[model samples]
Target: METVEDVTRMRLVGGNLALDFINTRTGPAAGPPDDDLLTGYPALIAWGVHAGALTRAEAARLRRLSRDDPGRADTTFARALSTRDDLDEVFRSLAAGGSPTAPALARLRDHEADALAHARLQPGNPFAWTWREDHTLARPLRPVVHAAVQLLTTAALDRIKGCEGCSFIFNDESKNRSRRWCSMDDCGTTEKIRRYVAARRTRARQ
Candidate 1:
C-alpha cells in the first residue's frame, strides 16, 4: 500500500552534516513541496547513502529489510521523518540568529542519547567516530543526530546560513565568510535571473 521512489532527490547543498540532513525537503519546510524525497523507508535509506552515513551495500541491505519487515520499518521511517522535522525547528532558530532554547536543546539531547543508545564505539581512523549496527533499520540516522548535537554544542552554528532564494540551510565556509545560496549552479543562478528580470522591467517602465 505504500508508494515509494527508489531514486533519492534529497539535496546535499548544506555544507555541514546536520544541514545536509535537513536539506532533504526541497521546498518550504511547512508547505508540501513538489515531493518529499524522503517518502518511505527506502527514501530514508537512500538519503543515508547520499549523506555518507551508509555505504551502498548498507543502504541496499536496509532497503531489502524494509520490504521484509514492513511493520517495524514503517515505525522507523516515521521516527526518521519526525527527527527531520524536529531538526528543522532546532536549526531554524539558529539560522534566525538566535540560540535554541532550553526545551529545544533538551529535545536534541534526548534524540542524541536515543541514537547512541543503539550505537557503539566503532574503530577506524583515530580522528573519526563510527558505529556499525547489523539490524537497526534506523541506524543510519544516528550519525545525523550526532551531527546535530555537534553543531549545536560547538561554534559551528555561527557559520550556519539559509539560502535567500529558497531557505535551504548551509554553512558559509568561504574565506571571507560571504558565501550564500545553496549552490552557485542552482539557487544562485535562479536569483541572478530574477534580479536581471527585475532590473529590465524597471527600465522598461521608466
Candidate 2:
C-alpha cells in the first residue's frame, strides 16, 4: 500500500510537467532551462500535481529520483519529455473515448509500455514501481495523472501560466488571474527590486 508520503512526492514532480509545458521565457533567449527541459520523470509527475491529480508526496518521490540516481536522470528525462506521435494519437483517442480502435489504443499502450519499462529501470522504493508495477493499484494511478492533465489542459489551456524566471506552471486561479510569474520569492522579488532601482534613477534625473 502506498503511504501519504508517496503521494506528496509525486505531486511535486507532477507539478513540473505543467511548468515545462508553458516555457515562458522572452526574447531571443526564450527557451526552457537545461535543467527543466532535461529532468524528465520528476517533471512528468509534477505535471500531474499541477493538474491536481497526484498528492504532494508522490511528486516529491519523483523529484528524489533525479537526486538519488543521477545516472538514469538523462535517459529518463529524455523518455519523459519526448513528444512522440503516439502520445498525440492517445490524446485524440482519449478525447473521442468510445472504445477507440485497437490501433489507436495500441499506440497508447505501447507508449505506456516504453514509459513503464524505463521507469522500472530507475532505482527507488517499491512504490516507485507502481508506475510500472503491473498491479491493480498501479493501473489506476496512470489514468489519474493523465486525466488531471486533460482536465487542466481542456479547461484552462489558454490561461495556463508559466514563470518567466523558472519553469514552473500554475493555474491562474487568482481572482485577478493576471499572474505572469511563478512565485514572488523567486523571479517576482528580483524583478520588482530591479525595477524599483531603475525608477529611483529616473526620478533623480527629473
Candidate 3:
C-alpha cells in the first residue's frame, strides 16, 4: 500500500523512539506556515512509520482504521499528542533532578497497562517483546511507555538532555555524553550562524 502521506519534513533527530514522539510537537518544518510535524491523524501515522514505531503496511492499516471512524481516531490522536507533551514535562522534570508529579506517574502507569494489554512474548526469546497488532491507533505510542520505563529505571536518566538550540529533548549517547541540540546540522548550525552574524554586527557597530 502507498504511504498515507509524506512525512519527510518530520525530524527524527531524537535518539530514541519516545523522544521522537516528543520532538514531533516541538520543531516546525520548513515551508509556508511551517506547521507542526504531526498535524493530524494521517500525519501521526506517517510519523509512526518514519520513527520506526510502525511499518508501512501497519501505517496503511491504521490509515484505514482512522478513516473508518474519524471522530474516535481524532480523539485518540489528540490524546496521544497530549500524552507526548505530558511525557516531555515528566522527563524534563526527572532530568532536572526533580521528581515527577503523582499525576504524571499515574498517567504513565495507565499507559503502561494499556501497552501491556496488547503485548506478547516473541517466538525465540521469552524476554523479547512484540505488539499484537500494528493497526491499533495507540500501538504507535507503546514504545513511548516502554522507553519511559527504561529511562526511569536505568542509567539513561543521567543522559537526558535538552537541546540548547530549540529546547527539544534527546538522549545524549555520545562517548562523553556531550550531545546537545536535537540535530547538530540543523538547529545547532542554525543557532551558531545566528550568533555569529549577531556578533559580527555588534563588532561593526562599535
Candidate 4:
C-alpha cells in the first residue's frame, strides 16, 4: 500500500535512474509486489522528482498538464508502465547471463531515440545532454531513457544485478562485485533474521 509519504521518502537504492525506476515495485522473491509506488501519472511525476530526474517546478508543471489532459496522462502512464516492464525484462535477462529479447530491445531503442531527439547538448567544461523544457506528459521519461542509454553502453552494464532477496534491480558497484542484497538495512537484515530463527528452530527440534 503506497502512500504520498512512501513516494516522497522512497528508497533510492538503485544507483542509476533507469535501475531505480525498475525498482519501483517491491515484493517477495516469487510473487506479486506488495507495493507499487507509481500508482498513477502523478505518482510517476513524484517519483521522477524524488529520483532527481525532474526538477520540482518541472514536476509541478507536468502534474498540472496531466490534470488538464487526463487522456494523454493515462496514455503516458500506460507507456511508462510498459517501459518499466520492458526495462526489467532486459536487465533481468542480462543479470541472469542472457540477452534481452528482440522486441524489448527494439522498444528500448525507440524510447532512447525519442529521448535523444528531445534533448539538447548543454555547453559546459564537460558538455552534457539535457532535456528541453517541453510541456508534455512524457517529460519525466527523458532522463530515464537517457540513463538507460548510458547504462546500456558503458562498462557498468556488466554490474547490473537483481537483489538476492527480492525483485529489485541495482548496479553492483562494490569493489569485488560481491554485494548481494539491495540494501543491508532491508532485505539483508530480513534474511539474516530468518536464517537465525530457522537455525534456532532446528536446534530446538533436535
C-alpha RMSD values across all candidates: 2.7, 11.0, 4.4, 1.8
* Regions more than 4 Å wrong, model 2: 1-29, 36-77, 83-148, 152-154
The list of candidate 3 runs beyond 4 A from truth reads 1-6, 27-35, 132-134, 198-206
Give the alpha carbon lDDT tens digit for every residue of 1-206 in model 2. Answer: 33323433332321333232323111212343342322335444555565554566665665665577666765654544443333433332333333246775565555555445534443566334335343221222354334334443465443454455554445555677677666676567978998999999999999
lDDT of each prediction vs. the true structure?
Answer: 0.77, 0.45, 0.74, 0.87
From the highest lDDT down, the ranking of the candidates is 4, 1, 3, 2
What local lDDT does model 3 show for residue 112?
77
Q: Write the per-residue lDDT of candidate 4 for residues 1-206, one digit (tens) a residue.
A: 57755777878998899989988887876567687888889889989989999898998898889989999999999999998988888888887778899999999999989888888899998998887566678889888987987898884666888888998888999999988899999999999999999999999999
Q: Which lDDT tens digits does candidate 1 get at residues 128-176?
A: 5565664578887888988888776775666787777775888788888
Q: Please identify which of the two predictions, 3 or 4, would achieve the higher lDDT against the true structure.
A: 4
The reply for model 4, stretches above 4 Å from the true place, is 32-34, 201-206
Task: Give the range of the ten consecutive residues with the poorest summed lDDT in model 2.
Answer: 20-29
Weakest lDDT window of 10 consecutive positions for candidate 1:
1-10
Clashes of 4: 0
**Which stretch of 10 consecutive residues in model 4 shows the poorest summed lDDT?**
1-10
